[model samples]
Target chain A: MARTLITVPRTAKRDEIIEIRALVQHSMETGYRRSSDGDLLPRDLIRRFTCRFVPRVAANSNAASTAGDLIFAATFHAAIAANPYLSFNLRATTSGTLVFSWEGDNGLAQTETVSLLIA
Target chain B: MQPSTQALQKDDTQNPAMLWVKDGEALWNKPEGAAAKSCASCHGEISRMKSVATRYPAYSSTQRKVINLSQQVNLCRVTQQQASQWPADHESLLGLEAAIAKESRGLPISPPTQRQLADAQKHGEALFNQRVGQVDLSCRDCHETLAGKKLGGNVIPQGHATGYPIYRLEWQSVGSLQRRLRGCMTAVRAEPYTHGAKELIDLEAYLAKRAAGMKLESPGVRP
Candidate 1:
């Protein structure tokens, strides 16, 4: 399993800027390196990361119509270190769930979600 | 240690070794082997293991020998979980060791004073001071006498085992104290002891005593 650690405030005041941190485990193996037997090690890495905020619908509003706002995204390359970590700032405008996903080589895809409350 | 490297170790998010610690935590609670028992099944909460790492390279009555944390882990796996022993420096082994040691973070190194452990420590001290290998240099020559001085591009820090299962940039992974010692012996062109060798355990025992009262920083990030 590709384990990940994420940090986000459990609750924040409206419009407050909060820091979010995400760390994911991966070898991020570069294709250039040769094995001890001199065979080239194939490249394996997480190629992309994205975080989106799915805003909570009001009691009277249509939940199905709610939309997710893209908060951050990045494209990782060979130069990125193993167990990549990314930290970003987000404005707490509404109560919502933050979705984090990673897509990578070898058909790797992982997604995790954490809830947040804006008081 | 350089300030930047120290900073890297201090932050959990930036430290790559923490990935192993996280894996270890998961392993602690997950069931394994025929009995389907996890470390938590018998040990209860992970917090129960706190301060346990401070006393290691301990004498084991069952094995009738001195063993380090990794050996103790294997013992539990075989005896309690009925699982096969993990090879030395295996990711799962390193992860479990890292997780256990992390619980003792900020606690002093407190090697036991049992007679068998004492013997191992003494032997280890002698080995540390003895000249060996093609270069005819002992560990003391560089880690003790020349510590803080430059050797090529790197500075030789005191040979303390305070932080282990350390995340060495060179290795690009978490490694045990035994693995690091083997690397050093090889660097000196010495016929290095095999993994889990008694001599290596002895060295680890002595280093534990040598570093007594120093705080542990397992899963340490090193340059």
Candidate 2:
């Protein structure tokens, strides 16, 4: 629940679409476990996440959720490792910031914003 | 892929990441401590001490705490041999822990117990789901969302610890699972804890148990 990662590629070809992969640290506890004391541990996991991009090239060239949108959202399972990982693609653009965010099972959340540039 | 083929890809021990395992092995028996106590000097031939590494992050009633083998080893060095404890990411420590976990490949992961072990697990589970950092990403984000899907140029297989003490070419040496965990925390811009720290072990115990029924794969590899 406390760990996450964000990596924005240094450069991308204007026409080339590449995937951004990530993994986080969390137990994704299913609430089915008992501690050594035999008490139940509540279920907690990252429920969902999103990636977005906004154009910064020209002053008025903001990308819409439709065109430069990550558009892909994912739901992670509790059985996955701590710090679950994901990958999504973004359309190549001149310059922008790619935003990634996640919300977990027990109400935990995190977000990462990275700068991007396309030559 | 067929189930068997799928199984093979998921088996990290057999993956190319095992090069670090060999490195850890060389370091394990070599003597460099102040008291001349190599891991072999006290633990003996690790191959014969089956499963010791797999049951780590277990609770310790003697210390009223939960400790992993790495921390335990550090304790021994400081207390038993009058040597300074190595930092969690110290090459010798990571190499040794990775090697031990690697040796425990395919073994069972049983966490040690203490009076508060359950509470620790609960806290750790909460931490896993608790949101931190600006990323707002939880541990479940990738492993669960895209489990078994190819992501970021690699398969987002289940976040299982069949591999620990893995070899990351990126690290250029054996890496303790805690090291990877630390990487996660750092990426999220959270405060990083020392390797082999109790919090790290608790998280480790929780994840390994969650990954129960899966064979151990110490000294695993990943891109």
Best by lDDT: 1
Residues A63-96 of candidate 2: C-alpha lDDT, one tens digit per residue: 4443345656888776665435566676775677
lDDT of each: 0.92, 0.67
Worst 10 residues of 2 chain B by lDDT: B11-20
TM-score of each: 0.95, 0.56
Q: What tens digits encode model 1's per-residue C-alpha lDDT throughout A1-119?
A: 69898989999999999999998888899999999999999999899999999988888887543448889999999978778889999989989899999999999999999999999
Model 2 lDDT, full chain set: 0.67
Supply every candidate's count of residue pairs whose N, Cα or C atoms clash at under 3 angstroms.
Answer: 0, 35
Off by over 4 Å in 2: A1-119, B1-19, B31-34, B112-114, B194-197
The alpha-carbon deviation from the true structure for residue B133 of candidate 2, after best TM-score superposition, in angstroms, is 1.8
i-RMS, each model, one decimal: 1.5, 9.7
lDDT of 2 by residue, B66-181 (tens): 77777877887786566788886676676667667766667777655554777777767777776667776666776677678876566766677667766554554456778888
* Ten-residue region with minimum lDDT total, candidate 1 chain B: B167-176
